[model samples]
Target: MKLAGLKSVEGAHDESAWAAAWVPETDTRPSLLLTGSLDETVRLWRPDDLELERTSTGHCLGVVWVAAHPSGVIAASSSLDSFVRVFDVDTNATIATLEAPPSEVWKLQFNPKGTTLAVAGGGSASVNLWDTSTWQLIATLQIPRPEGPKHSDKSGNKKFVLSLAWSPDGKRLACGSMDGTISIFDVARAKFLHHLEGHFMPVRSLAYSPIEPRLLFSGSDDAHIHMYDVEGKTLAGAMSGHASWVLSVDVAPDGAAVASGSSDRTVRLWDLGMRAAVQTMSSHTDQVWAVAFRPSGGSSRGGRLASVSDDKSISLYDYS
Candidate 1:
C-alpha cells in the first residue's frame, strides 16, 4: 500500500487543527470529512476535492476531538472546556450537550454498534460511557491507580486519560493515559480488564485493527508505535522512525496498513505486514495532531487518509 497526496487546504482553520473523523455517506451526500480545531470550531468538508461544506461554532475553548455516529446523521465534538456537543450532520442542529465535569473530555468515540459513546476523561482517569438514544451518562470505567507513594494524590496527572479506541467487535474498550498505560475494559460488563504496558511517556493515540479485533496499535510521546495482543496480554511488536512524538494513528478499513501523524510535521504510512513505515510525507510546517482513514462503504470509492496539523492545515491522501 502507498499514499499519494490528493489535496491540501492551507489555513483550513484559524488555529491548530486537533482532531478529525470521517462521516459516512448518506443517500443525498458523499462521504464527508469532519475536523475540530483550536479555533473553537468544527468544520465539515467534501471529500476528494475537500471543499468546505459547513462550519459549526459554539465551543468556548479549543475543540479537542470529533466523532461521527455510525448512522452518518449525527456527530459529536468535545472541547477543551469539557463540553460535548452532539449535532445533526446535515442541519447542524444541536442534538445534545454532554459533560461529566470535573472530568474533562479528551478523545471521543462512538461504539461500533452505535449504542454508546465512549469518551476519554482527562485527569479523571476514566472512560465516560454515554447512552446514545437517551444521551445520558451511563457508566464510568475507571482505571486502577498504580501502586505508588503518589497514589494518595487522587488528582495526580499521571493517570490523565488522553485517547480511546473500541475493539471492532465492540466488546472491549481501551484507553491510553498520560503515564503511558493502556487500560482495556470489558464493555458489556463495564469492568476494567487489564493494562497494556511498554511506553513510559504519554500514549496520545490508539487504534484496533478492523479485521483482527484482538490486534491493537498505540502511538506515544516516546516516538514509537507499539502493537499489542490485547486479549493475549502481550506486546506483539514496536515500530519506530518518527523524529518526534507520534500524535495520532488509524488503521485502514481493509486492515492492510496503518497511518500515523507526528509532531515531526510528517504523516507516515506503515505496512502492517512488514511492521515498518513504508512511506513518509512531510508537507505541514507544524506538528501534525490527528490522522484518520475514511471508513469504507460510503460514496467514497477508494481508501483515503486525512491529517490535521498545528499549522492550521488539512491534507487528504489517496491510499492504495
Candidate 2:
C-alpha cells in the first residue's frame, strides 16, 4: 500500500536513464533489474544493493525502451537510432537485430506468453509483431488513417506510435500514439480493433492491470494519468497531480496500486480504489523517465519498484 526508499544509485548510467524492467527469476538466480540509458548502454543489476551484473553496449543514440520476456532468459530493447536488439539475459549474447525501415522503432514488448514481440512503429502508425521463435516479422497491425486525410499527408505523423501493452490474456494488444489515442488490436486476427480516447497529448507509457485483462492505465504529456476500460472503450477515471508530463506508468504486481514517474521530478504511487496518489517520492532531481515494478507473485509480491531519471540516477523502493 506504500513505498519506502531502499536504495538510490547515483550516476547509474553515463547519461539519462530512459527505461527499466524486471527480468523474471531464473532457475539459477533471482530476478534482476534491467535498465537502459541515453548513454547508449543497457545494464543489469542485482537486487537490494543494486550491483551491476552486466553492461551491454552496441546501441547508438541512446536506448529508448527495454522489455524482458516472461521466461527471464531473453530481453528486447529499442534505441533512438531505430533498431531493436534481442539478446540473452545472462550472457548478453545478441540473438537478433531487427528493424523495419521507413518505420522507426519506438517502444517494444514481449507478450505475456513470450511467443511474440510487438514493436511500436513510429511514422508507420502500426505495431509490428514478430514471431519469437524464428525471429520473423509476422504482421503489422496498422492504425487506420482518419477518414479524410490523404495517405501522403504529413499530419499522419501525429498518430506516431510510442507505447504499448499486451493484455494478460495475450489475445489483445494496445498501443498509445502521439496524437493522444490508444488503439487496441486483436492479436490472432492482426487487425485494429478500436480507439480509446481521452487524452489530447502524447501518450508516453502504458501498463495493464495484471488481474484485469480489459483494464489499462496510460501516462501522457497532458500531465495526467488515465484509467480506461478498453473493452468498453470508456474512460474509467483520471488522476491528476503531476505538474509536468507523465513519462511512465506501471501497475503494482497485486493490481491494487499504481505507480508513475514524471517530468515533475517525482514518483507517485496511487491507491486504486480511492483513485488518488497516496505517496510521492521526490528523490530524483530531473525528469523521471521510467518506473517499473518487479514482476513476481505469491511470496514475493509488491517486492520492488524502480524509477530511473534524466538525472542519471536510479532509485529503488520497497513496496508493501
Per-residue lDDT of model 1, residues 43-99, tens digit only: 999988999999998789999999999989999999977799999999999999997
What's the lDDT for residue 196 in model 2?
A: 87
Q: Runs in model 1 with CA error above 4 Å?
A: 147-155
Error of 2 at 259 (Å): 0.3
lDDT of 2 by residue, 1-320 (tens): 99999999999999999999999888888888999998999999987779999999868779999999999999999998888999999888999999766448889999999999999999888888999999999998998754333234566788899899999999999999888888999999988888888888999999999978779999999999999999999999999999999999999988999999999999999999999999999999999999999977523445799999999999999999
lDDT of candidates 1 onward, in order = 0.92, 0.91
- In model 2, the clashing pairs are 1-320
Please provide TM-scores, in order, for all candidate models, with all chains considered together.
0.97, 0.96
lDDT score at residue 152, model 2, on the 0-100 scale? 44
Q: What is the total number of backbone clashes in candidate 1?
A: 0
